[model samples]
Target chain A: MFFFKLPFLNLLRHYGRTSLSLVSIILGVLVIILGRGTITGLRESVIRGEIDGMTGHVSVLPADYPTSGLLHPLDGLYSLPPAAEQWLHANAVAWTRRLFFAPRLVSGIDAIRVRAIAFDPATDADVFPRRDWRVEGRIPETAGDGVLLSRGIARTLSVQPGDMVVLETRTVAGAMNALQMPVAGIVSTGNPAIDSIILFLPLSAGEDLLRTDGAISHVSLLLGRRTDADAAAQQLQELLGEAVQTTTWEKEAAPGLEAQDLRQRFLDILVVALLVMAAAGIANTVLMAAYERIREVGTLRAMGLTRRGVAGLFMAEGFVMGLIGSLIGAMLGAWLTFKYSIEGIDMTALVEEMGSGEMFQDIPFSSMLYFGFSGRTILLAIAVGMIVATISSLYPAMIAARKEPADAVRS
Target chain B: MKICEVESVCKIYGRGAAEVRALDDVSLVFEPGEFTVISGPSGSGKTTLLNMVGCLDTPTSGRVVLEGKDVSTLGERALAHVRAKRIGFIFQSFNLVPVLSALENVETALHLARFSGNRRKTAAEMLDAVGLRDQMRRRPTQLSGGQQQRIAVARALVKHPGLVIADEPTANLDSKTGTQILDVMRQMNESFGVTFLFSTHDPRVMERARRIVSLHDGRIAEDRTREKPSAAGEVALTSDASNESNA
Candidate 1:
């Protein structure tokens, strides 16, 4: 009790020095919180946008198809047997069939190379709903010479809904054929690559035009629960054997996965650099405070304080500094997040070079970017602050403890 | 009975040609309630002898017996325990912590001695006894040199230790203030039966002491007892008489 009062009063007496040290600590803590929060928010936003924009949780592709490597000539479409389809129906919650191929699209005087996707209207509607796609007209329901053109493609061809367009592609026998189909709708998917080059048609019409019978390029699935995606993919692979292949959304979207990995590595490097700088600032501030209080420490020792007691006193000071700094940093970080959450920071003018197309569209700094205060983040911040403070005080506290009573008196 | 007994205590500085013996073959006895002064020139080992008796420093050789316990054989922690409970010290510079009020400074000794219950009141009583009742709430820097020394004296006596070791207790004060401080010590000695041992070179301090031990060249030169002198000739008689008697 007697020992506790002395250090508290000492800190009060030297309020100027104490406040200076606290400010340095607060700046360090604020940097840590803001840096980590921004990086985490960015990663989460990118992942969520990617998942919702195109890829579902899991996808099923042909076993012979090398999805991750350079595209070689495809070895025809493979079909899932009745038993496999039954397993999918029983175990999977949502599934769709996609027939994708690169071909030449022609409308009037405009002719452009494009990628075409054929899917079942009923099943694909549950996953990538036609309502969410920006459309100039209604999507085609029956599969008879009907097609959907992307907004960019519609502009290039000077075509609108009810206009006729031609698609040219090689049939399974390697003969090129052209088929004229009516434009049922023009879609704007907001992604530049998808907006400019993608066309969608019904499965039966795509099969007839390509001269294939009941064969699909791949099947995409969305499990009832995301966590079950990986396990379902594995089970589908084992059940389908070597002739068939199964791929999950994470694997099929290799570019997105690689981007996420690169982002995490960059964030790790940045966090380490910030922590080192913070520790240095804290150490320097604490060292100065400790030296200034040499006489005070000596007096406490003379007043029957043990060496442990002396160390505890300085440790208390460090702890208080860290705690106050962390609290201030949390408040500052939360305020920044809240302020930006309501009024998003627009990057459209800044990123004008990336084009104004919907695909290369500006991502508003929305409330989605606002970080929620989880218990984990708070605990981690406190632990980091305290650990840094304690480590910085070790050298200074040791110096305080080793002082000689007589020499201190003389000084 | 002797409360403190130092026998053949020696404290040396360096090795061989650079050697300096701060206290060489110094032996002394301090009785229970006597006000004794150890006087000497600057490097004559008076402070060294006082440190050994106060259990603040251990001798290089020989023993310091306090109340029949040989302190030289004890470990560092045990020596600290002895210092806390059995001995009190008043430094020449009035080594009170600058952050603490005068009352808190005095209460420190009692706290270390584990004396509980009404500690502030007891500390106030001690400060009043030393004639600094009004200055109890002021810090050491706020008080005068004489007032700070009086607080030190109060700190030394508040724990009611068997012995109080004061090193140059009047070194930083004026003659009149020093005398007033000494009068408080004399009163505490008479009223509370607290033994006082001072290491000083001041003639006024020596005159007030009932027993005087003089040191020279790190060794005791003379030890004598003085029958209490009247106030008028006390300083002159103690100085002149000690010189003639020793010569």
Candidate 2:
């Protein structure tokens, strides 16, 4: 107890200097918590966008379809085999048929290029409900020319829920086709890229406009358990043979996810840089303290304190400072993350103002971002802080301990 | 039995052209309950001899025996143990650990000695004995020089060491404060039967000591015992006669 008390009291002798070291430690730990949380939140957001807005847990596409193109391929439309359809009905939690293609919109004297997605009105909601979107009007239903237009696309075409427009596109059989449709709704999906150039229509309308007779571009399945997607995809591929290709959402989103992982690695390096800077500050402070207290070291030595005891005293000072700063930093970081997770950080205006919406087309970044907090991260930050502080202080502590009692007294 | 013995101790510093002999073939012995003052001019080796005897240092070539054990060649760790358990120290600046209160300063000595008893009570009692019972909680900066030295004396006596080495303990005090500090140390030495060794240029301290050893260069110029100055402040050094007086 005296050992601890002595070092604590010694540190108080120069409270200003001690507080400087403490502030550095706190800053380093804060960066660690907040940086890691931001990266984790980003990864979660991308996964949610893929599973909910684009791909279901498992998807079956035509064998020749290319996933890397900017526009969806309409040349490989296929009718599902009876055996594959039977297996999906028995093994899947829910399933839906969808068609994707690029179309040019003609409104007034303007013609704009955009992507269109067609959904089966009845089963699409069960398999992949886009609960994240906020729509001004109702979704398109069966047997009509009504369509849902993204807010950006509607603004570009100067159309509203009751407005009429013409969509011109190429059929799977390589024939040019055009259709007149009435807008049913304007949807804001929060992702600027999707809102800027997307339109949703009924599958029946899509088939009539494109001249496909009961054929779809793909079938997306929602599994009973998301973790069972890989196995189910394999089973579907075997049942369907070579006519269709089965894949999981993870495989389809790998490129974007890989980019996110690279960013995470950079964040990790920044965390280490911050911690090292803080540790350097601690080392400097401890070394300065040792130099200023040479007389005190002599006095303690003459009082019968051993060299090891002297070293331990300095290390204790570092330990106490590190512990206090790390605890406060971690708690404050957790609190901030929790608050932001609930309230969310809105970057919609920023993204729109920057006009970088197209950059998010492939990665699918939503404007509202939330942070992640974990107890394990907090504990690890604290441990790293203490270990860094103690190790940094070792050289200064040894320097103080090695002083000769008589020489130090005379000095 | 001798409380401490320095046998032909020699301390050398540097080498060749820069060689300096701090203490050369100096021999001395102290007995229990002796109050001795070692006085000399500047750089006369008074501190070096005191350090050797106090276990604060070791001579380049010599033997230092304390309480029937040779400690001259002991390692730093072992020497620290000898100092902690059986010796005490006082310095010119009081060296009271400015962060600690007067009582806590005394408690540190007991802590180093590994005293397992009630440390606070023992430290407080020592302060009380030194006539600072009301100032136990005041830090060193809060106390006067004389009071700080009294705290130092209390600290040195708290462990009940067999010998207390004071290196110019009164150098930083005024005449009045220095005399008061010397009076407190003398009382402790007499009451506890502990040997007191000091290095100083203060005439008042030398007047109060029963033995005076004067050093010149690195050798002792004189070793004599005398009765403490009388109330009239008169002292006559009488060679071996003071030994008979002690008998």
Expressed as tens digits, the lDDT of each residue in B1-247 for candidate 1 is: 6898888788897999999999877777778998988888988888777767877578899889998899988865576677777777887878787889999998887887778678899999999988898999999999999999999989988888889988889999999999889888888989989889998888887778888788998888877666773334353224334222332
- The C-alpha stretches of model 1 lying farther than 4 A from their native spots are A1-24, A42-50, A66-82, A105-215, A250-293, A330-374, B102-147, B173-180, B201-204, B229-247
RMSD to truth, every model: 5.3, 3.1
Score residue A306 of candidate 1 by CA lDDT: 59
Judged by DockQ cut-offs, is candidate 2 incorrect, acceptable, medium or high? medium
User: Which candidate has the highest DockQ of all?
Assistant: 2
lDDT of 2 by residue, A148-259 (tens): 9998888877888878888999887889999988888999887765777889999999998888888888799999787899999999888888878988878866776788
Q: Clashing residue pairs, candidate 2?
A: none
Instruction: Give TM-score values for chain A, per-prediction.
Output: 0.78, 0.93
DockQ of each: 0.35, 0.69
Candidate 1 lDDT at B134 equals 91
- The DockQ of predicted model 2 stands at 0.69
lDDT per residue (tens digit) for residues A41-105 in model 1: 55554444444444556666666665421142336586778887998799777777878776789
